[model samples]
Target: MQASDRYRLSASATWVASVQMEPAIGAVAANLARSIELVEMAAAQGAQLVVLPELANTGYMFESREEAYALAEPVPEGRSSQAWIALAQRLGIYLVAGISERAGGRLYNSALVTGPDGYLGTYRKLHLWGDENLYFEAGDLGLQVFDTELGRIGVAICYDGWFPEVYRRLALRGADIVAVPTNWVPMPGQTRDGAVIAHALTMGGAHSNGLTVVCADRIGTERGQTFVGRSVIVNSQGWTAAGPASVDQEEVLLAPIDVKATRRARQLNDFNHLLRDRRPDIYDEQSGATAGLRQR
Candidate 1:
């Protein structure tokens, strides 16, 4: 069979990533209602999957862990997460949304993937920002790729995308498409200097993994911090299939992805996978102390 013929393709399915705009700070009710409205709107537009920005429910300026904890909810049962799950079930689609998670008396910055089958998976931000370490414990969960109606989908939150290891890990785990929901703050000169870096990260990850990478970053300012609103979708061969948008307004970017093509492209081109074919036997050699290690 042809390489493309060997893979599954669902032409009827469409994926939408909502660059959820932030409302006024501490406006929990407003944010909740806005998300629900977007869910309905996305469904009406024929989206089989939808992604939301980080910290969708609560604002990002919480001064203390206590405040964030007070808003966190369990993965399958928190009030906010329950609403998202119910929406996914009601809409009969897959939804990945970042939420402030509270579990076992601790707060976490987490993302949940819900489908018609209730909660599909959850990802806690493995990489935390500056003061984030003070409020929430860093997540020990590794990269994740969940089987969905659309395809094998990988999930990662904001800071997780900054490191190449995060993307490589997800790709190694067999991800066909990676969805990242972020509130990526753009530093003053980073945009000019960082465009190349950002492009390198996106293209390198996509080409190497043979997976389409879709990133949905928040627009507008939140908690007096500016965000880099360039939500984009890159194809397997390191091509920008979709765009790099502006940070000024609320926008919904759409792209029809061919998952089979991504796989085929990798095979036809024999794309960069040298990193995947490393000699672990020699790489794992433990050096520091032979006698002490053997004695212990």
Candidate 2:
């Protein structure tokens, strides 16, 4: 092999881990400004990419389905996403953010990933938790992953974190990291001071899938509901680079990540190798009952 070829292969990986936690139920204009402020700050701090909390532009709690509908907006065409794309271009950094997305005539909780080049891609929340079913429609699309200056990354909105398979599928398909933008409601009867369940879900998904998982969430009380804002970054080994938690203020959180570590971990443990070891021959419930001549 040529010396230049070896040098290129050995080039160091450059990336950043960052999150923005918006104050819950805050005014739209205020939230947007805070988000923009953080975007610029993260870029100045050397972040190649930044992720803001789920529904960071709008608070998560709702009084009725109509309220959620009122907050929803079309992607790229909507005010919130348009601002995000423009900001990404301005800062020349990749951005991942969650928003209430409007489609056709209904709304779906969704996440969008944008790069300096332009708006890159989006993913809608596929698994709606209890109360969410009452307001948002579940997205039927499969997991999405895209290439960025940092690395190949996948986006999964809130409830999607509970299902480890989502991360597994993305990692198997070549995602080096997964970004989760969430508005995590505390479990049934747990006190806010108790160990955060959402962080556990995020770390579990990352460790099991052999990838780093970064999450951003909103904080403060909104419409009679309260959230424990602990926006965090977790490594493939399930360790928190930041603490166990943080508050829901309009704050910028940053950490450094080594992309090469993700590849090495996957090669060593290969926890997600199950994607290739599946036995489809006996898994017939997915389609025709009689297997003699299954319909295409």
Candidate 2 RMSD to the correct structure: 6.2
For model 2, residues 1-296, the per-residue Cα lDDT tens digits are: 43245335545634444565654453667777788887787777666778888877777876678887887789878988999999999888889988888888888888878989999987888999777899899986679889876888988888888887788779878888888888777787777677788888877877766788888777777777777777788887777865445655555566556787777665444454524544556554465345655644
Q: Against the true structure, whose lDDT is highest?
A: 2
The residue-by-residue lDDT of candidate 1 on 1-296, one tens digit each, is: 32133223444434555555664456766877788787677666666677777888776767777777776677768777889999989999888887888779777788888999898878889999877888888886778889976888898877777787777778778788888877777654685225834556777888776778777767666667777677777777778866676656666665566666665565643654534554455443454335456678
Model 1: which residue pairs collide? 72-102, 73-102
lDDT of 1 at 122: 85
lDDT of each: 0.73, 0.76
- Cα distance off (Å), candidate 1, residue 131: 1.6
Which segments of model 2 are wrong by more than 4 Å? Answer: 1-13, 23-26, 269-296
